[model samples]
Target: MKFMAKIELSRHIPLVTLIVLVLCITPPIFATKNCDFPAIFSFGASNVDTGGLAAAFRAPPSPYGETYFHRSTGRFSDGRIILDFIARSFRLPYLSPYLNSLGSNFTHGANFASGGSTINIPKSILPNGKLSPFSLQIQYIQFKEFISKTKLIRDQGGVFATLIPKEDYFSKALYIFDIGQNDLTIGFFGNKTIQQVNATVPDIVNNYIENIKNIYNLGARSFWIHGTGPKGCAPVILANFPSAIKDSYGCAKQYNEVSQYFNFKLKEALAELRSNLSSAAITYVDIYTPKYSLFTNPEKYGFELPFVACCGYGGEYNIGVGCGASININGTKIVAGSCKNPSTRIIWDGVHYTEAANEIVFSQILTGVFNDPPISLDRACYRK
Candidate 1:
C-alpha cells in the first residue's frame, strides 16, 4: 500500500514574503476599467451651488427654477445648475446643501458651495454683507465636522443610518470644486485694476490648493476641479464696465484675460499637486472654454441673447435690479421678471447661466475635450 504525503506551502514560505506575493498578484481597486464613484462631495460658489447660500440666507425668488423645476429650488440658474447634471450623470440623487436642515438626504453626498463664496475668507460674512461666510476653509471645516457627525449617527444603526453615506463612501467619492471666480470678481468690484487682480492670482490659487490638500488628507482621492469661467462675459460685468475693451463676442477682453491668467496659475499649481499626490486623481476642468464658446457663438448651440440677462430689470444687458425684486421706475413700481423663453437665453440673472446653457456646458465638459490630461468625468477616478 502507498501512503500520500501532504505538502503545506505556508510552512516553507515566510509570512511577509507570502503576503507580498499575494499583494503583487492582486490588482488595485481603482485599476479596474469601470471606475465607480459612490458619492460626490462638492465645494464651490454659485456656478455649482445647490442651496448653501439660500439656506444660510434667503432663497432666490420665482422664475429662478421655473425652466425645469417650475419653482424655486435654491439654485442660481433658471432651473438646474451644472452640479445637478453631474449628479444625474452618475445616477445619484442631487446633493443636499450642508447648511440646509429641512428634509435633506445626504446618502450620496453634500454640497458646501455658496453664492459669493471665495477661496479666501471674505471681509464680511452673512447678516453683515452679501458675501457668503462659507469660504473654502470654512467649507473644509464643515466637511470635517460632517465626517465625524455622520460616522457617529451611522454607527447607531437606525433608519438614520440609511440616510447618511456609508463609511466607505468618503474614499470612493468624487470631490468637485468650481470656485475662484468670486475671488477675481471681488477684486474688480473693490475698484482694483486688472493688473492688481492678476497680481493676486497666485495667492488665491495657493489658498485653493491648500484647501484641496486638506480635503485630500481626509480620505478624498478623486477630484474634479473646475477652472473659473469667463466672468467678463457675464451681463453684470459687461454692464458695469462699458468702457472696458470688448472682444468680437462682446465680452470684456481685459476681465476675461484676468480670468484666463487665474486659470493658468491654477492649472500650473494643480500639475505640481498631481505630481506630489501621486495617489490622487486630480482633474483640472476648463470651464472657461465651453462657457466662452456659448457667448461667442450662442446661435451655434441653440442659444440667443448670450450676454443679456433672462431675468433682470433694464439696460442693454437687461440688468438694473435683482431678478425677482421690485424697483420704482419713474414713480411706477415694476417687478423684474424672466424672459418669455428662458431656454433661449444663456445668462440667467445677469450672473449665472440659464438651465439651457448649463446643460450645454455639462455636455461639452463630459466629452473631456475641455479637461486637463483629456479625461472625461466618468473616468476621473483613475490617475493619468
Candidate 2:
C-alpha cells in the first residue's frame, strides 16, 4: 500500500514565519558552510523523517500535533526532527518535503523519509498502509525530479534547457539516507528469535547497500549513512516486554547488541563502497553512542528523563507519540505521558529524539563520528 508522492492539489500552504528565538541555553553556533556544496538531501525512515510521509499518513490535530503550534507541522517531533537540526548545523535552509513543491527552495534539497519505511521494503508501521520502502521512495524522488525537469523544459523552451537539463536535477545533489530499523523491528515483533533475525540481517542490510549504490549511480556523490539504535529500550519494545533485562543505563543490552552487530557490518560495507567508489563522499553517522551517552549519563548532559519519553506515557512516546497508544504486543492500550520540556530530554517519543536531542546528535555528526582525524568524509566533498 504505497501512497503516492504526487501533489495534485496545489493549495496555498500558509507559510509560518519562523523568527529567531535566542535560547538562554546557548547562542546558535554559526555553521561553517561548504560553499561548493549546494545541499544535503536526506532519505530514510522516522528517525530522520522530515515531511516525506506527511502526505503518506493522516496526522491531524489532537493525537498527532497536540503540542505543536496548535497543529501538526507534518513532523514526528514535538518540535524538530534530526534533518532539521542537520540543516541548521550546516547553515542551509531546512530541506523541504518531497510533497512540497514550493519553488525557490529546491536547490537546498528535500526530505524523503516516510515513517515506517525500511531500506529493504516499504514497511510503514504507521496506521497507514504497506509503506514506502527506501527503493520506491528513491524512485519516486527520481520521478519527481523528472517532472520538475519537464516543467523546466517547458518553461525554458530551449534557452535554459541545455545548461539546466533534466539530468542535472539529481546530478547536482547529495543524498543522505537514514533507514533499516523497521526490517529489524519486523523480525523482533514477528515470531522470530534473535538468532533467526541474525540470519537474514546480512541480506536485509545488503538490500540497502545496493540501494545506496543505485543512488550513487544516479549522481549522488555525498551520502550520510545513519545506523540503528537499541531496540529493547524503545518505549514500544519496553512496554511489550516487562521482563526484558536492562543494562546499567536501563537500556536493554541484548537488544543493543543486535543494533551493534548490524552497525558493524554496515560500517564495513560502507568502507568497502568508499574504496570501490573513490569518487563518492560517504560518511556513517552512528546515532547510538551519542544518544546512549545522554541516556546513560544524564547528569553530564544535564537532562533528567532518559527511559520514558517526555511526550507520551505508557512504556514509550515519541514527540509525535509514535509508540504512544500504539497497540501493545497484545493489541492493548499502553501509552500516555509527556515530559514538560522536550528540549531537555533526548528521547522524543519512544523511538525518536527531541529537537534538543537532535542538536546534540548533530553536534556529534559535525565533529564526532563523521569527522576524522582529518578534514572531511572524502576528498571529493572537501572544500578547496
Candidate 3:
C-alpha cells in the first residue's frame, strides 16, 4: 500500500507544476496596475493651470502655445503642464479645467488652478475684484458642488454616471497642490522685504495645512504636494531685478533664499499634518532641487538656455516683454515670436517653464527620491 501511495503522489507532481505555471503566466482578472490611481483633483496657480484663468481673463494667447500644441490652449506653457504628464502616466485622460464651461467631462478629473490665484483671499480687495471669485477657497466650494452633482447623477442611474463612484473616487484620487509660487511672487512684487516675506511664511504654511485638513474631511487621502521651484531663476525675475544682484547662474540669490526658507517651513508643516492625519498619505515633492539642477547643469538636461524664455522678447534673457506682446516695430505690428527650438530651453515664457522642463521635473518627482516618506505615486496608489 505504501509503494502504491508514493507512485500516485509522483504522478500528481507534473499536473501541480503545470497549474503553478499557468497561474504565474496569467494575471488575475481584477488586478490593478501600480500607477492606476482612479482620478486626479488639482489645485494651484499657473504652473498647473490648464484653462481656468484663461476662460476668465483671456490670457496666454497666440505664441504661448507655438512650441508644442501650435495653438493656444490657455496653458501657461507652450504646451502641456506637469498635471498633463501625471495624468498620462496613469493612463488617464487629460484633465479639464473646472471653469471650462464648454462641455467639460469630469469623469476623469477636474483642474481648479488659475493663473494669478492666491491661497488666501486678500483682505483689501472687494468681493467683486478681478479673479476673487476663483480663489482656492472658491475652488474648494466648486469641488463640493461637483461631488454633489456627481452623486445625484449616479443615484439617478444615468448611463455614464457609473463611471466614477463618489466615495471610491474621492478616496482613491490623488490631490495635487502646486500653489505658493504666486503668493511669493505677489509679496516680492509688492516690495516686501525678504524679512517681511519670511514673516508671512507661517501663515502661508498654516493656510495650506488647513486646506489639506478640509480636503481630508471631504474624503481625500492621497496628496502630492509640490514645493515652490527656484522662482529667482525665472527670466521674469532676472529682468525685474538689477543685474548686479544676480548670482553666477544669473538668478537672484535673495529671492531663491526666500523660496528655500518657505519650502523648509512648508515641509515641517506637512510633517505635522501627517502625524495628525494618521490615515492620510501626504507626500511633499521637492520641485526646487531638480528644477535648480536644470538651471545649474543645463547641458545634462539638453537645455542650452536655462535662464532665457523661449517665447519672450527684449532684454538679455528675452524677458523685458511678455509672450504674445504686440510691438510697433518701425510702424509695423510685430508680435513676439517663439524660439525655433523650445525644447532646448528650460523657461518657456518669462514666468513659466517649458513643457520639456515640466516633463523632466515631473519625471524626477515620480522617482520617489523627491517625495517625503520616499513613496512614489505608483507605490502610493498600489492596492497591495
Candidate 4:
C-alpha cells in the first residue's frame, strides 16, 4: 500500500507543476471584460466644468481656448480639460453644460459642473461673486430635474427628442465627481487657520457623501470620485502663503497636509458607502498623487516650470492673480498673456491647470494604478 501511494503522488506532480506554470505566465484578471458605459454624467467645479458657469455668467475672454478651439469656450484651461479627454476616450461627444441651451446637444451626457462650486452650500455672495451659486446640492437637484425633463421631451418625440438620451442611459452611465478643493481653499483664504480648515473636513465629507447617496437613489450605479489635488503646489496658494514653510518641491507643507487629511476622511466615507450601496461600483481616484508628481519631477513628464503659471502677469511665479484678463499691478493695468509654449508648463492661471498637464493627469488616472479597487476607467462600471 505504501509503494502504491508513492507512485500515485509522483504521477500527479507534473499536473501540479503545469498548474503553477500557467498561473505564472498568464496575467491576472482584475475586472470583468471591459464595461460598455452608455453615457457619462459629470459633476464638479472648474477642474471638470466645460461651460456651465460661462453660460450662466460671463464667458472667459480670449486666450482661454486659443490652443484648441481658437476661441473662448469658457473652460479655465488654455485648451481642453480632463472631462473633454474622458469623453473622447469613450468615443462620446463632449458633455454639454446643462445651463448651455444654445447649440448644445445632450444625447450622450450632460455636465452640471460650474467654476467655484463647492461640495456644501457656500456663504451668500454679492453680485458677480467669485463663488458659484451652484453648490453640489443644487447640481444634484438639477440632475434630478434633468432626468424628468429629458424623459418628457423624449416622450413627446420630435427633432428635440433626438437630442435627449434614452431613459435607460441614466442607470447605465458613469457618474464622476471632482469637487471639494474650493471647500478647503475658501476656509484657508477666508482667514481660517489650517487647523480650523481641517476641522470642517468631516462635515464637508458628510455633506458630500449625502449628495452621493442622493444621486445613487436616483439610479446612479457607477461612480468615479476624485480627491482634491495638491493646492499647495499651485502658484495661487504659494503666493497667498508666502510666509508658510515650503516643502522640498516648493509647495506649502501645511496646505497639502490639509488636502491629504480630507482625502483620508473621504476614502473612509467611501468605504462605508460601498457596503451600504452593495450594487454600486464606486471608484475613488487619487488625482493628487499623479498631479503632485508633475511638480516634484516635472522633467520626467516633459514639463518645465511646474509651479509657474503659463498665462499670467509678473510675479515670482509669473502670476498676478489674473490670467487671460487685465489686472492692476502697482497702479498699472497689465494683461495676463499666454506663454510662448503652454505645453511645457504645468500651471496655467495659478488657479487651474494647463491643457498639457490636464492630459497627463487624465492619462495616469485612466490607468488602474491611481484608482481604488484597482479598476481602470474602462472597467469602472464593474464591481470588484
Best TM-score goes to which candidate? 1
Q: What is the C-alpha lDDT of each candidate?
A: 0.91, 0.63, 0.81, 0.91
lDDT of 4 by residue, 29-136 (tens): 753367777789999999999999999987888789878877888899999999999999999998999999899999998999999899989895424567899999
By lDDT, is 3 or 4 better? 4
Give the per-residue lDDT of model 1 (tens digit) for 153-222. 9888898888889999999999999999889988998999999999999999999999999999999999
**Which should have the higher lDDT, number 2 or number 4?**
4
- TM-score of every candidate: 0.91, 0.75, 0.87, 0.91
What does candidate 3 score on TM?
Answer: 0.87
Which lDDT tens digits does candidate 2 get at residues 1-384? 123322222123222321222243355432343424456667777776666666655442333344444456567767666677666655777776665443324546656667777766544544555455444346445645744665667586765444332444465555677777888777877778878877778987788788788777667777767777767667667666656678877777767788878887888888788789877767776767776778778777767767667766433334334433543547676554456676677666677766677777667666544432233422225321
Comparing candidate 2 with candidate 3, which one achieves the higher TM-score? Answer: 3
> Which 10 residues in a row give candidate 3 its minimum summed lDDT?
124-133
Note the clash tally of each candidate.
Answer: 0, 12, 0, 0
- Residues forming the 10-long window of minimal summed lDDT in candidate 4: 122-131
lDDT for 274 (candidate 2): 79
> Residue by residue across 1-384, what tens digits does model 3's lDDT show?
999996787677897786787789999754554655779999988888888887766757788776667888889888888889999988987888888877677787888888777777754332355333466777788888888888888888766575544557888898998888867876887788878988888888888788778878988888888899998898777877765267787788989998899899988999888888888888888999999999999999899978888987888898766788888878998788789898899988888988999999989988889778787767665321
TM-score (C-alpha) between model 2 and the true structure: 0.75
Candidate 1 has an lDDT of: 0.91
Error of 3 at 117 (Å): 1.2
